[model samples]
Target: MQASRTLSRSGVAVATARPVLQFLAIMLIALVAGSTFGIWRGYDPGGYSALTFLETLQGAVGGLNVTLPLMGAGALVMTGILAVMARRDRPVAVAYAFAFVLMAVAAVITRFANQPINADVVTWTPDSMPANWTAIRDVWWHWHVVRTMLSMLGLAVLVLAIMADRNRSSAPSA
Candidate 1:
């Protein structure tokens, strides 16, 4: 009876953790994608050539088109789950909620600030490159730094929330 009860509790714990795991996985993907972009920005070997840099930026943005939506959706769903969990664990829920909001803010920054820069970059040709192309590229890099930090922070908070949940589940019941 004791073993069976323990197994049942374990199952419940696993079920409860599923969404958190999903959220973490999504955040990890976003972090990796953002980190790749940041590394490219830092190591841009073709910095002197506008055509090469613009081509690279175009490819990077194309990849982001897929990852960004997944990250946004993951954050939204995680926020909803955390909101429901708030009924029982308000503190952890609140922390996770705020983290997810930060993640959303990151996405907003990418869309509003970075996409416009990407759009401008995509339209540039070697012959028609603007005098301020480097300035615009610098702006894009700045916003990418902001979003990357935000996503990483969100991931850290979600990990903390997972730890809290595990501790709560394992505590001795009165």
Candidate 2:
């Protein structure tokens, strides 16, 4: 590789993008994974909320809340880009595509599953809680765990893909 793609024929910048896109995807997924980790550890469904479940949910939506949409969007966009970038390299491409699918599934789980529960939960007060509060909470918790696992799994696959890609890049040509 030449010192720069500035010369155009150097073709150096083209190679740099695979690793950069992989890194961005990794960082974004890692952020989402950490959010899931924090939720499970700090305010899981098992935790009692004297105030109310809605209050608990609302309270947790302060600092991290603003960044969540951005993180999710950034993660998906970056992962998709990485998947497309790796398209010519079959094994590496497949890995990135799998990672993107995993992340997308997590997004779908949030949009269709968790968001509905969240909407209902927002209408609740301590005294207004339905007789089946725990049941609703249980459903929410189950999906949360599933999506969290998928997000982390995506992160792992992304990291490995980047590693494999770099190895291929560095290998001496036959």
Candidate 3:
């Protein structure tokens, strides 16, 4: 009787673990993507003064300094756990792997392309703002667009992978 109870509890754990992992990965990446989208749409400067722009950017950088890295790390860890758990299932594993790679690419874009500019933008005052600020801002904006698209795609891919995994799990046995 004790052995049977232990087995039942194990079964319950296995059943719920995957759902929790999926939820974590999806929600974290969704938050990162959603926040990026909001920034692109609502905070593009639109001809604001250099001081005003730098102030807004400083506020944005402050929040993102905490939020983006945490969300990206959580999403990657959860997706990697899912991928490892699905390793015996080739298609599902591959889908999760692809999702991880896509998200990693987005992170790379953020780290290498976008963040240096953010750091500099946060340091500038109206008097100290670079004479070539327009060019710098345009470049930052372009990379922001790229990461935004990549993150959105990564989220979509992760969702599709979850659906595929569920469908395969529920399919009738051969």
Candidate 4:
């Protein structure tokens, strides 16, 4: 009985530590990439112009190209690891793990969907834009915005789970 209890406690320790470590690793990469891209975008020579819609699109997409890939890779890799460590019976951890999966999906959608729009924008002038370009941009950009918001919410949930686990572990023994 005592041996079983010890093993269980150790298992919890491993589970608790895994997400925090993953979060830190992923966040470090994200912060560095995000900051670097932000600087690049800020210093871009093509200041916004009504005639330069495509130029602005190129810059926006370029920034996302770097960050989204990193975020996607991190999400997919960490989620795979987290899936193994997660205890299905624990609701909070399960939810957090699911959030990682959502992030991965969002990253992929942004890559394939938004990136193509950006590619077209780079070569396109307003007059040359496809008949439905405005509609396409409106719908796709809306989805991208939602995904960004969802990612933030997901991160918050994951952090909450980590903090809850930490608190439970640090509580005085019964």
In order, what lDDT does every prediction score?
0.69, 0.78, 0.89, 0.60
Task: Give per-model TM-scores.
Answer: 0.75, 0.84, 0.89, 0.65
Best by lDDT: 3
For residue 36, model 4's alpha carbon misses the true position, in angstroms, by 15
- Candidate 1, superposed: residue stretches over 4 Å from native: 1-48
- Model 4 sits at a Cα RMSD from the real structure of 5.7
Per-residue lDDT of candidate 4, residues 149-171 (tens digit): 55655565555655665565577
Task: Give the higher-TM-score candidate: 1 or 3.
Answer: 3
Task: Write model 2 residue lDDT over 1-174, tens digit each, in one string.
Answer: 364546674356666666677777788889998898778777786666536566777565545544755787787888788768767788987887888888888888877887788778767778888888888888988988998898889888878877877787788989
Cand. 3 TM to true fold: 0.89
Task: Report the number of the highest-TM-score candidate.
Answer: 3
> Could you list the CA RMSD of all candidates, in the order they appear?
4.8, 3.4, 2.2, 5.7
Q: What local lDDT does model 2 show for residue 35?
A: 90
> Higher-TM-score candidate among 2 and 4?
2
Q: Rank the candidates by TM-score, best first.
A: 3, 2, 1, 4
lDDT value for model 2: 0.78
* Total clashes in model 3, counting residue pairs 3 or more apart in sequence or in different chains: 0
Which candidate model has the greater lDDT, 1 or 2? Answer: 2
Each candidate's number of clashing pairs is 0, 0, 0, 0
Ranking by lDDT: 3, 2, 1, 4
- Model 4: residue 92 alpha-carbon error in angstroms: 3.7
